[model samples]
Target chain A: MQQSNAPWRTPALIIVAGCLIALLTFGVRAGFGLFLEPMSQDQGWGREVFAFAIALQNLLWGLGQPFAGALADRYGSGRVLALGGLFYGLGVWLMAHAATPWQLQLSAGVLVGLGLAGASFAIALAAMSRAVSEERRSWVLGIGTAAGSLGQFLMVPLGQAFLAAYGWSTALTLLGCGVLLVIPLAGVLKGRAVAGGATSATTREQTLGEALREASGHGGYWYLTSGFFVCGFHVAFIATHLPAYLVDNGIAASTAAWALALVGLFNVIGSYSAGVLGGRYSKKYLLSSLYLTRAVVIAVFVLAPLSTVSVYLFAAAMGLLWLSTVPLTSGLVAQIFGPRYMATLFGIVFLSHQLGAFLGVWLGGYLFDNTGSYALVWWISVALGITSAILHWPIDERRVPRLANAAP
Target chain B: MTGHRHAALLLLAVLAAWSLLLGLALWQLRLNDEQAGKVVVLFPPAWDAQTHFERTLRAGGLVVGQAPLANLWVVYSEQAGFVGRLKDQGAWIAFQPAPFAIVTLGGCFSGPGALPPSFLKTRRLSGDRP
Candidate 1:
């Protein structure tokens, strides 16, 4: 019996690297909401002021992702992470000392958003996916996602503690420093092949514009993009406003923070489980189920008794459904189009997600100011979730036209 | 034939296991019928100028009556006016109807004419003086 060389080792290493990258990127982003109230109170700014900044951060993050992903795909993930770390550090420092709303917008919103785009799992997972075998791709993606969820869990509580002791500005500065830790991990991502083997069949490489046109022409891409938009809206709205909502409802701020943390912790399990399941089941059905579950969970939570227990329950339920979409969504993109320009294509899809995020975060603040209730925002989330569930139902998850023709 | 049948049986077993797991998780989740308790509710005192501003309080499956006259107090901050008054010192509607249940909602209220019948209830009760 011939001993097979440990072929699995490379994939395992790539998964670990992906997980660490995810942890640093999302941990900081998840903790951003914790600063909303404290920073606003200190600066005498309205919730909308900070909300707008975070909304911009989300938008720019979406905008920056494809470019970052392309750069990493072309050059390697090392340089991207290094550059992102610098920007992230600078952004956090500026946020710490920000006196004006515009400064907050620039530092926290634009800079951090772009920094995260460069550093996040979108790029990291693409790199990992390319490095691993097709059989392990979904599992690797899941591990990467679960790492980000773990970051959310760790960072939210840490942010809460920082707010308690050192204040928001100082806490932000320290958190920024923590993001810089990713710089070292980026070294491990060096020297991998940029394009997956499947992507190289076409003689003529499509330019970004041509790629966009090709993707746009495909009905599945639009469905993916539109459904992803709801995911963004639901996540960004809740992340930005739920703490404030809890505070308004007379719940203790710490309890609200814990609610957010619990979401992250449970999502760790949910995302990993979803990834495992995606391997065996139809990815589309799994995605549809996730969205529908989100709608049902949100509707039931809002209608149920509001208490610490309910808050945690809601958080856990929602968390499990949260970002469980990422692995499946990105997995489908790869499944449909191959991983040649996976980063760039996924970035465009993510742009739609960010657009929804922009609306969700901004609209939450706007509506709150106008109506003094989050009822409308909650209902919109439910509607969007249901819509997303339906949108993903009919997507033909087959290889792209060009790829199909070229294959032997 | 044997290999194909074995593969099919394996697939069925996996599916069955997943179904059982999902069903068990769903069954464990308790569905509560009670609606979320409002910790605080804000309304203009003018809305209750005539009638007694009644509010019910509930905690731990126990329902208790609260006399609006005794429990509900009209708070007037100097910072507010006819419109600003409610804006400044709006009524506190307790969602949890308990001491520890945190306040959840705060806002101002405005309407036409004098204070409502509920607001006048306190005055009427005070008016029956000898």
Candidate 2:
């Protein structure tokens, strides 16, 4: 039965807990790149070696997201998150001292990927979604997404300073400590997620199998997934390679850090605005326009002369576009399938996103190694942005008939 | 109602603590101690020039370590007369005196080791532009 513990313990605690998890997990993940040059130099390996490991991590994260949600669905997100935190801490700790490339792959790549799956924004966002009122869902989702931006803004410099002060191994161990903070936050999210919102009291709970079947058959769902993949590609490629690109081009390392921080800082606004806007407008159109704008922005950035001014401008512009898609994409999934199976459906969609992330990060390194440049990747991002722009245009945003008929 | 209020309050307190931790972490990152009087001395760009350039540093005083950039040596204790001798010997030096800047960038990558403060800055590397 769907029951609320009370108002105090209800949505408020859930939101705070969810947001904190988003901040910690996302924040810790964002700062890993600061260790790249230092780590590779010490290990006597190429940049692609480190890049490939992180790319594998993203691939594993994508592969694990759906299963993590499934586990959360079956056994409750609390236990799953606890398990995730454990793995995350262990993976980071192991990564800190990994002496061999294979070990680095296992710890940073495989284990961290699995850990992220369990502790990702999906679990927290899904928990909050189930707890909040339907009318307030998009607003709450935006807040959660913004917290992720906050994490990136705050953690990057700290990670850099830590890398500078304590060395990369000790600095990474500190990040491991930071991620462990999520484990306790998971406990507060205890209790089963009720399929709240528009579903009536008499509506029967949909089986996981039924939801999967419905989503696979829906053309719009496929479109949404494919569009989301582009988001992952753009975000991952930049996160992994942008700093190195700037540094390689004779720009100060601080500017690269500032650029990333600016992205995180502005994404707070972008994500929140998208959330607020989704409630009043067509999410599909908004998504389409956002993608189109990304294509234009990337084209302009690449064509323009590269300078410190250009870099900061690009960061701020991209920041506004970055992660804004999260609330909308997840909200669309919720709207289409109803909030009942949101974590699972969205997780599957997120899988596609991670797949794109894997390609983006991997190809950034692979191509850079072969060609001695990131030029090809930049144009590829522009091309993917256009494809996603068109793909998101045709998504049918109307609620599925089952949910519509069942609602009051 | 009381239980709900207590839960909300508790959660708010947790949030406050988390914010404090993040603020503290950022504060910690800003607390870098300047590596006083450190400098990256650039040897002439030619590949064959590196060995002789290293020899000049050894003859000048003491080469602290081999830098990442080719023909760059991290030298310690800038001797006033000795710097002139190195300059006369055909070496360009970037004097990083005090209160050096640290920049932090984000990438979702892995960690390996620590780099010296001198290599972290680009403008100090080679005088390409302003």
Best by TM-score: 2
lDDT for each residue of candidate 1 in A1-408, tens digit (9 for 90 to 100): 001123543544555666777876776676675576667788899877987887677667878988987776556666787788778778888999999999999998888888878887887777666666666667667777776776665555455445544567777887788777777766666543433244454713755567667888989899999999898888778866676676566665657656765676677778877777777788888999899999999898788767899888998898888888988999888777776567778877888887887678679879877776888889889999999999999998888787777665
How good is the docking of model 1, by CAPRI class? Answer: incorrect
Residue A328 of model 2, lDDT score: 92
- Model 1, residue A376: displacement in angstroms? 3.4
Candidate 2, residues A1-408, lDDT tens digits: the string is 132344456677777788788877777877676677778889998777776777677777888999998888766777788888888888898989988888888988888889999998887787777776666678778777877766666665566556655678998998898788788988877655555545755234677788889888889999999999899889878865777677777776767766876777788778878877877788888899998899898889878877899999999899899989999999898877777677788899898887787788779879877777888898999999999989989888888887878777
Task: State each candidate's clash count.
Answer: 23, 3
Task: Give candidate 1's TM-score.
Answer: 0.68
Off by over 4 Å in 2: A1-8, A37-52, A97-102, A196-203, A243-254, A365-376, B1-35, B39-130
Q: Which ten contiguous residues of candidate 1 chain A have the minimum total lDDT? A: A1-10
Supply DockQ values for each candidate.
Answer: 0.02, 0.12
Instruction: Return the TM-score for each candidate structure.
Output: 0.68, 0.76
